[model samples]
Target: MARTVVPYSSLVANGSLAQPAGTTIDQSNGMYIAAARPELTILRVANTNGTDRVVTIKAGDNPPALAGGQGDLAVTVAATSGVQFIGPFESGRFIQADGTIEIDFAASFAGTITAFRVPRGT
Candidate 1:
């Protein structure tokens, strides 16, 4: 039997989730998955500076599918604001795999995120 492990990761940004330098997903950063299960994982985030930060997770192509048509996983943080719980969204609702997923703050305060997991009976 073949086994698969979800590509667990997280990102934190100052001022905005979108940035010129953007963010990176790795151990050197302050984000990491401390606990994980077949269906869920706990992410730990520590605010380094006073500036409100936005953290996000982006699944490449072939993300886990949601059980229902709950929609793609997307996170939205208001301007100059931060969010704690971002998802449980469907992976298919965001975009096609032809290009990178983008979250434009100039267009809206809402951000795009990956669905945390699919519902049962998908």
Candidate 2:
């Protein structure tokens, strides 16, 4: 069954989503769960050093997964060298690299990056 999600609101009036109790917010080896449906939301990742990064996201057990790409080619992100689209379904697989992906995204994105794995080839 699809898990019901709620709309995201600023509990502090700063337009920042509040972290749920017992939720992990570490950028290194951590994960971030966005609101039920994220509209006009952007997610970005940057390496602390000029090194390569590799990350992956396994599919969940839901539907209407996250969207990938931008504009015309704005399709679902499959897999890339340093960039990847997590997924829209409840379950999927994702792997991202930093040095490998230089121009994967067309639109500018900004969001909290949840890294649960150390960057490979760093």
Every model's TM-score: 0.28, 0.28
Candidate 2 lDDT, tens digit per residue, 4-121? 1212222333334444322221333334333322222223333332234343333222122222221112233322223333322221112112101111322222122321211223
Among these predictions, the greatest lDDT belongs to: 1
Q: Candidate 1 lDDT, tens digit per residue, 29-105?
A: 22222122224332222223335445444442444323324433333343433434443323343322442332222
The Cα local distance difference test for each model comes to 0.31, 0.27
How many residue pairs collide in each prediction?
A: 14, 11
Local lDDT at 9 for model 2: 27
